[model samples]
Target chain A: MHDKTIAEISAGLQGRKFSSVEVTRAFLARISQFNEELNCFITVTEGEAIADARAADERIAHGTAGPLTGIPIGHKDIFCTRSIKTSCGSKMLDNFYSPYDATVVSRLQDSGMVMLGKLNMDEFAMGSSNETSYYGPVRNPWDLTAVPGGSSGGSAAAVAARLVPVSTGTDTGGSIRQPASFCGITGIKPTYGRVSRYGMIAFASSLDQGGPLSRTAEDAAMLLQAMAGFDPRDSTSVDHPVPDYRASLDDGVEGLTIGVPSEFFDQDLDSEIAALLETTIAEYQRQGANVKEVSLPNVGFSVPVYYVVAPAECSSNLSRFDGVRFGHRCEDPDDLLDLYTRSRGEGFGAEVKRRILMGTYALSAGYYDAYYLRAQKVRRLISQDFHNAFEQVDVLVAPTAPSVAFGIGEKTSDPVEMYLSDIFTIAVNLAGIPALSMPVGFVDGKPVGMQLIGNFFSEGRLLNVAHRYQGVTDWHLRCPNGFE
Target chain B: MDLSIEDVKKISALARIEIEQQDIDGYVRDLGGILGLVDQLNSAETDEVTPMAHPMDQVQRLRVDQVTEQDQRELFQSQAPQVEAGLYLVPKVIE
Candidate 1:
């Protein structure tokens, strides 16, 4: 029962095979047994989970339950849950629980999904690996020594370990997709404005977007059905009507066009990853997908542009943590400046500090035009490159990461090496397009993921490609060793 | 783009993060490598292209100005390090 897909779980609830309490308890037991070893969860809300599960059972018994009535899902610590600790994996907000639920959490609650607990993440969603988390780094369920890709690393690790059937994750600059790839799970980062960001603590607001991480693409589709919608509180949210994501699972690539960027296969990429990507592309071609070579000439400079833009926004957004309102404050200070300086100094981790400095430099009085303005211009060029490619193809294909998950702490002391891991993913955020990472096959003993990117509002198309591939292969369903 | 230990210290002070002297050299090297790669944007031409700030070009949608939520100050302030009667307490500033 614990290993069944979301669709199968929903069917079981409809058929009265098992009660919601029974299923929720199974997940709770699994979490207790594995969470200490994996360190994927920040807090477990067993009390709330049981109460919600009982309510769901009552609803289903009365024939009033909806699609996700009995399914269990976990929220990334970044999303504000009323009366629950929404730490964002930072010591600053370690005890800060919001008085109201985030719009995404509210929507999921409205849909009757059971809440499991808060998952761990990089502090303020800043790092490429989960090593920067204040609580501690999340261990990959596949290989404990390997990283679980990051910021959303905890969400991916939990789902891959089958602790929870599905979980929510936010991607600012590859947080969702990269971890999903490293942990061998299916996750999507929807286009900007597709999901509201009102109460999901800001980390580069223009780039942050929340989506789902699950064992299969079909489960992601169902989760997205509830998570995607416009809210008045989030001014940037799109008012576009939600589409039925499951409607096109059978829509295989009969005449579909997939763009393979020439620049993505450059010399800087690892040879093993490049070879694995070729096999995945060849699989699509065998499925009748029309694969064509596309060019994104300006893509080579995406890392520089992202570093400038993301840091600049981060410095501004993170300013609210000055110990004036609701987070960590200094023990004692002689002056307000001392309070501000000491609080922030003690609150943030090394990576967060590095970004704040870079951002401050980029947006400084003398360097604004040279750094921020120029980076914005380069961002436009990168977006235009994707637009031109999309004109010739429906979606683009590439390796999710340059290589499989590296060992924990391997690149922590070197920030540049860590930043390069996000090379393939940063451009998608810059272009504000929907992208997903699905497990393709294994490289050595670890899993590798193939990335599929689509034009804005093409989440349905991206899921269709992933779901079709997952139906024919066993990669998405493979569980990590020692997880049972 | 080559950052020195002094530069790292200055940047850390500017960012308001405390670090020991031993860690400064490593930060300088790491930041320099990243800045070195980031400087490539200088050669990439983005002339004649309008910078994109947001993905959609939708006009601003305004809502009527009104309070939609109640002030739960007590519930919210409970998480603060120091709080008073409906206000957050902090160290003295001006002597």
Candidate 2:
């Protein structure tokens, strides 16, 4: 039961092979057994899960079930779940419970998907690794000592461990894809305005977009089908038609034009990872796809531009937690300033504070033009690079991260080193293009992922490319030693 | 642009996050390092380029200015740290 994909589980439930209660209990039991070691979950709603499972079983009996009915799924802690602790891996919101559900949460719930619980993440979705999480870092199930790549590390870890068939994750930079690559799972970040952001805690609002992490591209497609589409509540939500993502999974790769960015294969990338990417592209070529070397010249400046833009937006977005309305508050205060400062100081973790300060400095009165506005101008150049490349190719392919998972304490001390982990993934977010990371191979017994990027509203094609490659490969099927 | 300890202090205050006096030096080093990396952007020739505020060039969607939410003040207040009657409580602003 634990080995089944979401599509398989949905079929089994409809065929009456097992009740949703039984499947939900199986996952809850697995979570209890392994959670202490991985720390993937921040809150496991056993009671609510059982109740929702029972309701799903009843719906199945009535023959009114959807494709995702009774499918157990996890939500990243960033999404607001009514009356549930939606801690964004921050002490500030550890005691906070939202009065409503995020649009993503309610949409999945309306499909009758059983919610397992909220997964852990980096504090306010700020870090490239789970080490910055207030709940503690999530260990990669592949190797217990290695760090699970983050912000959505818990979601990727849980899915990789088969605690859930699918889970929701948000990627501001590389949060979803990097962790998915580290944990050997499938994760995708749709176009920026493809999904609604209402009730989803803001972090670099311009770059943040929510998507799915699952065991296969097919599973991700099913999950994404339900999560995409416009919501009037979100001012930035794109008013576009959401296509049937699963409908294109079997679309062959014949004559598919793939762009291999020359900048993505620069000296900074590890040799072994580069070789593996070459082999993966070769496989795509064998399937009748034409590969061409393309240039994204301004993409080299992505990391610097991202640091400036993301922190600036984050500084403004995080100002809402000033300890006056909600979130953590100091025990006593001599004055309002003390209440504001002490509460925030005591509440946020180190990395979160660092980003807030960086953002504040960049957006400050004197430095705004040099830092924030200048970065935005460079951001346009980066997007233009992608636009130029897409003119010749249908999609772009690259390595998801520079390398496989690193040790827990490896890059935590040097913040710039930690920021470099997101080098390849950040430019996609900056351009608001759709990108997916799927397991390609392994290095030193750890998993590696290859990223596929497409133009805006091209999620279906990206899924098709990944799904077809998955059909010819078995890397996505390889479970961790202990996990199996 | 190197950050000084004084710059760190001012930035922390502006961001409304308190930094311990002992930690100011660490902030100076770390923030300076990050800014050093970001300074590479100065080399890019961005003349004649428009500063992109967002990925998509869409304007803010407007809805008719009417009440769209029900009264959930009590439910919202339930999560506040301190509340009296129907308002949030904070450190007194006026004497």
Candidate 3:
């Protein structure tokens, strides 16, 4: 049903053949019949997803279910679930809610999955495309006039419109592999403190991560093995050690190697994404990989050192959206600086007030040493050019963008053509590494991806080289055309 | 290098926000065509460059000033706009 996979819908709900309330009522009737032409949900939770699919069909009739118990997913409204409406899509959190949850939604509701809504993004997550969001621009379920790549463009258009088999996004820069390469799907991100950001919301906390947006790569390694581990309320999480991301799924690629960076195929790429990344690096050299080329020339200054370190850490994690606390305030405020300037000028939107005025003019005081200490020393020469190309490639590939899905508001009134569609995903979030994206081709008709990356807590060897290039590509089982 | 509308009204009053006067001539022509491509990172040449904040240059593990949350201050100021006893009310700023 909708081409199964999420370990075949958690082995059809652990073999009873069906039930998690009929797969969460067939994904809430395909998200109420295609989320109003793909605005890709801002809050759907259909009656708390049928009471969390009747409590995951009574925890698989008491066997105490697990491998994502009843599976359904979809989160990206910048985490924080609690009483639901966690609007990080912002009109200053439209109506707020969140009494708690986000430890990646209580570890995907402690692995019984099923939530089924929240999605839409890019406000505090600050743009790449989901047209700055404030709950609008999400479209690209493969070309309903393009433009999905974004602040996890509604979890890559609800896992490329199958509506949700796996979702949850995040990624600060290159907001989850440039909208899972303009909504073809698969996603990832991972590395930086691999997972736990307490309750998400804070955008650039040293480059926010939180992963998975799937269709495959073995369902983003089973939703990044239940949204990763370590969480002592995130002081940058990483206390490490949490493997088994579907450990080596058929680990093929004979001699591996693969790199190919030559400044990620230069001449400012996009010759149809450098000929579909040279035919997916010649199908990873006929599946035995070993490609090579490599070099990161300070990854051509990773988009001006990730726009001066993700807007100086999103202007200090959005000075706690001041309207004296909750979201969007100001009705009749005569003082307190007119209620924090008409509630952040009517709750931000315009690429979150141009990255909160280029992160308060690069942390003010005479432009913090010519733009935030020279974009943090060219972000340590772009992570010492990916620690000198992962000491000669074990993984790395590019074309995650530099063209494809350029229609909707064609470069939303140009913010440097939407920050050069995140120049090959801000040098893998400025080299904290572990990337992923997936789908391989399609140009005018949209989808493109490729990415992969790795190194530094190599997310289970980049999901075993994206599950052996999604086991010889069906372009992650193509879909999109008027939802079949 | 064009921005003036008094530098977009002094960076929209130091980003407290509120900009309109005919939307400042199309936001100073779309922020001077996106800061003329952010002034090509001002003559790229990160001068003997060093600026790479954190992608694991390590040294930031800290975890001892313990508290491990409990006062969910009435479930975090019940989304404050004016919470009472647990504080968070604004509009008097040093009388």
Candidate 4:
């Protein structure tokens, strides 16, 4: 039952082949059997899930159900769940229960999707590896010793291990795509402003965007269709038209002009991954797609520019956790200053505090123009690079990550080394464009993902292209060993 | 430019995160390494480019002055550590 894709399950539910409760129970059982080993879930709402499923069964009987009516999805633990622990994998928020639901959570609930649990992630969505999570590191389902890339490690792992059909994830740098790649599943980060940020717990407000991680593009599109839209609650949420993501999924990539950025294939990329990408592109050619070489020269500067801009925004956004309104607070204090410092110090982990400090320095009086302003201007140049590439090609193809998942604790000590893992996926966020990562094949017995980047608001086209590719390839079909 | 312990101390204080004496050395090293990584951006020429504060080019949205939110102070304060009589409690500031 866990082997079925969301589309298959949706059909089964609508056809009355089985009730939603049966599907939810099978997944809950799988999570119980495997979560102790994978550590993918932070909280499991079993009673609520069963109740939600029972309601969906009634809705189906009345013939008033939507496409995602019975899907069981996991929140990334970053999005607030009303009266539930939306920890965001941070001790700061561990004791915090939001008074209301995040826009994404409510929208999915409205769609009749059952909430399985809150997925684990990097504390405040800061780390490229899942080790920074206060709950503990999430293990890659493929190899227990290796990490499932983060900060959406648990989101990807849950879907990959078949504990759930899909789960939510937010991408700042490579949070969603990298983990999806490592876990050998599909994930998409919609255009900036495509999803509401209200109650999502801002990390870097300008860069963070929520989407879905699923076993296939069809499932991602189904989940994304429900998650994307405008919200008056989030000032940054764009009032753009939400298209039917499944409408064009079967639209073949015949004569499609696919761009291969030269910079993405530079010396820093792993040779084995490059060879695998070349072969994957050749498969597209056989399906009547044209490949063209393009350049995003300014794309290489993305990581450095992102490091400054993201932290600067984080420092400002995190100031709200001052032990007053909500969240963790110190036991006792001599003065206001003591209260503020100790509360935050005890609440945040090393990575979160380091970013806060980095942001503080960047936004300080004299350094503002040098660090923050200059990085923003370079960010413009990176966005322009994407603008130029899109003029010649319908989509740009690149490796989602430089390599397969590394062993846990390998790069935790070195922040820069960890940041480099997101080298390929950062520029897309800087440009505020939509990109999707789909499993291409494997290297060193671990899975690899190739990214499909498109111009702004082009999620449907990207999903269509990936869905067509999934039809031809079976790499995404292979589940991790011992899971079955 | 490497960040000194003094620089880290100042930054930590400004950020409102207390760093004890033992962790200052590690913070100094890691913060210095991070700043060093971002220093590579100095090479990019952005004199002609406009700074993009956000990915989308738009102005802030404004609505009529009618209040849309209800008073959820009691529910919201349920999670706070120190609250009394519908007010958040804090350390004394006045002498």
Candidate 5:
């Protein structure tokens, strides 16, 4: 039962082979055994899980259940779960519990899925490696010593280890795909306005879009069907109709024009991972998909552009934590200025503070044109590059990260090196298009991912290609040692 | 361009995040590297390109004004560190 896909489990649940509570208990039992070892979850809602599962069983018996009615899923700690600590993986919000549910949370609950609690993430969803988490780094289930690629690290790690079949994640510059790459799972970042950001604590508002990380593309489709939709509460959310993602999963990818970006296959790419991508492309070709080499000439500027843009937005977005309405407070204050400064200083971790300062410097009067405005222009060029490529092809393929997961402490010393780790995934965020990362093969006993990028609101097509590719490949099915 | 400790201090004050005396130098080094990386933006000829503030070319969605939400000030204030009567407590500002 633990090895089954979410689709299979849903069928079993509706067929009444077993109750939702029984499945929820089985996952809860797995959490007790593996959570301490992997540090995947921040909070495990044991009493709530059983209670929700019991309610789900009643709904299932009443025949008023949806496909995900009894399904068990966890949300990244960034989303607001009422009465649960919506920490956003930061010490500032460590004491905060949102009074309302994030749009994603309420929507999932409305779908009748049982909540297993919140998963860990990078502090305020800031870092590429999970090491910056206030809860402590989440170990990759594939290999304990390696860092799970982050902000969404724990969400990926938990699903990979089968603690849950699916979990929610956010991607602001590769938070979802990079960790999903490291943990060897399927994850997607819907278009900029696809998911609502109302109660999902803001990191970089323009770039932060929430999606799901699951064991297979099919499960991602099922989850996204529930998670995607316009919310009037989130002003930026697009007023587009939500399409049924599950209905399109089995659509074959024949005659699909796949664009392999020339810039992505650069000198900096790891050789073994490049070779694995070659094999993955061959499988796509075998399925009658055509591949062409396209160029994103301005792609080189993505890292620098993102660093400027994300931090500038972060500095502004994070200003709500001034120690007044919610979040952390200082011990004692000589004045109001002291209260604001000391509270924020003690609340935020080092990387967050660095970005905040960098942003303040960029958005400061003298440097605005040199940094923020200039980055926004270059960001337009990067988006233009994608706009051109997608004109000739239906989707673009690239490596999700430069390489497989790095050792936990390998690149923490140099901030630039850590920023470069997201070189491939950042451009998509800047472009505000949908992208998916699916496991292709293993390199150095760790998994590598092939990223499929689509034009805006093309999540269904991206999932179609991944589901088709996954049908012919076994990489998504293989479990790590000791976990099996 | 490298950021000096004084620059970092001023920026930290502007951002309203207090930096530890010992941590200032590290912020100087890290923020320096970040600035150095973003300096590449200067090389791009963005004079012809328009700055993109949002990913999609959309305006903020505005709706007709109405009373929509129930007052949940008490439930919302439950997590605050210092709430008294119905307001968040902070140190006195005026003499």
Candidate 6:
């Protein structure tokens, strides 16, 4: 029951093979059995989940169920859930319960999906490894010693472990795809503005996008279908028609041109991963897709550009967490400055503080142009590189990360080394394009992800490409030892 | 662009994050490392490129000016650390 995909579970619910309550209980049982080892969940709303499952059972009985009705899913803790603790994996928001649900959460609930609980993540969605999480690092289910790639580590870990059929994740840089890569699950970050960001905790507002992490592209499509659409509440939400993502999963990729960027295959990439990527491309060629070598000249600047832009935006966005309103506050403050400083210092983790400081420095009067403005201008060149590549191909394919998951605490000491984890995935965010990471193969018994990037508003096509690849490969089907 | 310990302190204060004095040196080293990395952007010739503040080309959507939310001050302030008289209580200014 736990191993079924969203589509399979939806069918089971429709055919009355099992009640939503039974399915939800199965997942809750799994959570109890394995959650301590992985730390994948921050909060398990067992009572609320059972109640929601009972309601879903009623909907299923009434024959008024939607495709996702009665399906169980988890939310990354970053999304606000009214009346539920929505900690963004920080001590600051440890006691914070939102007064309203994020648009993504409400949309999924309206689809009749049962909520399992909130998953853990990096503090304020700041780190590449779950090590920065206040709840403790989420262990990679495949190998408990290895760190699950993060920001959305808990989301990808839970989905990979089959604790849930699908879960929601937000990607500011490579939060969704990198973790999905490390955990051997499928995750997609839709085109920026494709999904509303209102009520979702802000982190680098320009790059953050909420999407789905699941076992397969087909399941991701079903989840994305419900989560994608416009909301007037989000000023940046694109007012575009939502496409039937599930309906387009079977669209063949024959004659589609897949761009292979030469820059992505540079000396910095691990040779073993690069060789695996070639074999993956060969499989695409066999499926009637043509591959061409393309160039993203400014691609080398992506990591640097991202560091400046993301931290600058985060610095401003996170300023709301002063002692006054919601979130943690220090005791016995001597003055307003003391209250602000101590409250924030005690609330935020090391990584979050580092980013806030970097942002503050970049945006300071004397350094603004040399750092912030320069990064933004170079950002356009990076976007133009994608534009040029897309003109020659239907989509771009690259490794999701340089390598598989590393041991916990290995890269945490060096912030730049940790930042390099998103090298292959950040440029997509810079261009506001849609990208998906699907398991392609493994290295040294650990999983590797191949990323597929498409032009703006091309999520359906990206899903189609991933769906066709998933149909031909069984990598996504492999489960970890203990979990299986 | 290497940051000094004083620079780290200034930035931390500007960001309103209190850094312990003992940790200032570590922050200076780490923050300096990050700045050094991002400094590579200085080499890129972006004179002809326009700054992209957002990923998409769309402008912010405008809506009619009307009150869409009902007064929920009590409910909203329920999560505050200190609330009195239906207002959030903070350190007094100009006392």
The candidate that achieves the highest DockQ relative to the unseen native structure? 6
Q: Interface RMSD for every prediction, one decimal? A: 1.8, 0.7, 10.4, 0.9, 0.9, 0.8
Which scores better on DockQ, 2 or 3?
A: 2
Superposition-based RMSD of candidate 2 using all C-alpha atoms, in angstroms: 0.7
What DockQ values do the models have? 0.63, 0.88, 0.25, 0.89, 0.88, 0.90
TM-score of each: 0.97, 0.99, 0.38, 0.99, 0.99, 0.99
How many backbone overlaps does candidate 2 show? 0
lDDT by residue for model 5 over A34-87, one digit each (tens)? 999999999999999999999999999999999999889989999999998888
Q: Is candidate 1 or candidate 6 better by TM-score?
A: 6
Candidate 3's error at A53, in angstroms?
Answer: 1.7
Chain B TM-score in candidate 6, rounded to 2 decimals?
0.92
The per-prediction tally of clashing pairs is 0, 0, 9, 0, 0, 0
Q: Which residue window of length 10 is worst by lDDT in model 3 chain A?
A: A356-365
Per-residue lDDT tens digits of candidate 3, residues A196-304?
8898888677878889888788888888887887887887777888878786777777788988888778786868878877987787788878888888876766787
DockQ winner between 2 and 4, please give it.
Answer: 4
What is the C-alpha lDDT profile of model 6 across B1-91, one tens digit per residue? 7888878888888999999888888888889889889989989998878899887777777899999999989888999999999888878
Ranking of models by DockQ: 6, 4, 2, 5, 1, 3
Off by over 4 Å in 5: none
The C-alpha lDDT values of all candidates are 0.89, 0.94, 0.80, 0.94, 0.92, 0.93
Off by over 4 Å in 1: B3-26
Model 3: which residue pairs collide? A376-B51, A376-B52, A377-B50, A377-B51, A378-B51, A379-B51, A379-B52, A380-B51, A380-B52
Which stretch of 10 consecutive residues in model 2 chain A shows the poorest summed lDDT? Answer: A322-331
Model 1 lDDT tens row, A205-257 = 87999999998999999999999988989999999998899997779797899
In the range A1-484, model 6's lDDT, one tens digit per residue, is: 9999989999999999999999999999999999999999999989988998899999989988899998999999999999999999999999999999999999999999999999999999999988999999999999999988999999999999988889999999999999999999999999999999999999999999999999999999999999999899999999899989888889888899999999998888899899888998998899899989999999899999999999999999999999899999999999899999999999999899999999999999888989999999999999989998888999999999998999998998899999999999999999999999999889989999999999999999999999998898899999999998
> Model 6 off-target regions past 4 Å?
none
